[model samples]
Target: MYSRFFSLMGGLAAILSVSGGFGLSDVHAAPRDRDDVFFRSVAGVWKGPGEIVAGKYKGTKFTCDLTGEPLDDKQTGIKLGGTCRVGVFSQPMSAVISQKGNSYEGKFLDGAGGKGLDITSGQVSGDKVVVGINRAKLNGAMVARVSNDNSMNITISVKVADQMIPVIGVTLARDIDQIAVGSIKP
Candidate 1:
């Protein structure tokens, strides 16, 4: 049961990686100014409701609270920490993301007593970001698009057997008060 929970958390993190507005790519290069601006623009607290759209957990609903903080002054990276709740179950999650040139890389910690999830590749454009994930038994991609400064939509898909299935979809809104006054620690 715990393992399943971790998998769920990992999937959620993948979704957050995209929804959080961080970009990823496969190249090693210097960071770009526009990427920095994009990350900074989305840095803050976000809260929303999400639903599992496929797989075993399909139809399960959850609420998420996530916080995005700059890892450095240059805005080259961001740290994400938060929790998601489904009925009586609550899971904590975190990620450390860094941008170089037009590419992005990051490590996702599901807070489920495991190493972490590796974000192998990703890219950012205008108000959107996409990231690829590689895990022991699961592989997929997450895509996010910001509709405005305050709202965004995220979709997470996982490769099951030989087919890609969309597993989660969420719509998030920036919490201005939480961002300005700071959020409660998870």
Candidate 2:
């Protein structure tokens, strides 16, 4: 069951570009063996796959991506994707996050033009990442690692709905494999 759940969470991370955002470690600019960062900066593009862990769609497939500009030194943009079951959902997601600071705050767009989902509690450490609603019921986490060769491995635990049931376990290494930093010039 844990293996199945982890697989699903890893898929969700891909669908969500779960690795894209601000607040990246100083490791971004530091002289680490890896030369680039996936989620920081003005314009960046990443592609990965995610899975469905609940409902009829459990263990399904989806494609996720992020595109946006830098505001107030923060990352802001549209995160939208395709679900094998559902056609499309667009989230106006933004993260005014600080990596070394241990906290992040942002909102998820409900659709193309509805209200946004408030992300009130967000935090990340070297290996753990979490986000949730303010006083409501919603949360998700990813335990991640990046090797010197620019490979990232992440595991996720999510608080599903009002039940707060942690549905997924630690995920195995799903390659969010590559990142295209800066603009996507047409």
Please tell me which predicted candidate would have the highest TM-score against the true structure: 1
Summed backbone clashes in each candidate are 7, 4
lDDT of residue 169 for candidate 2: 29
State the weakest 10-residue window (summed lDDT) of model 1: 22-31
Give the lDDT of residue 107 in candidate 2.
45
Q: Model 1 clash pairs? A: 24-104, 24-122, 24-123, 25-104, 25-122, 30-101, 31-101
Which regions in candidate 1 have their CA more than 4 angstroms from the true location? 2-6, 14-31, 100-102, 110-115, 160-163, 181-186
Per residue, candidate 2 scores C-alpha lDDT tens digits across 60-122 of 454444433333333322233322122354322333322233344444434112333444445
Give the total clashing residue pairs for model 1.
7
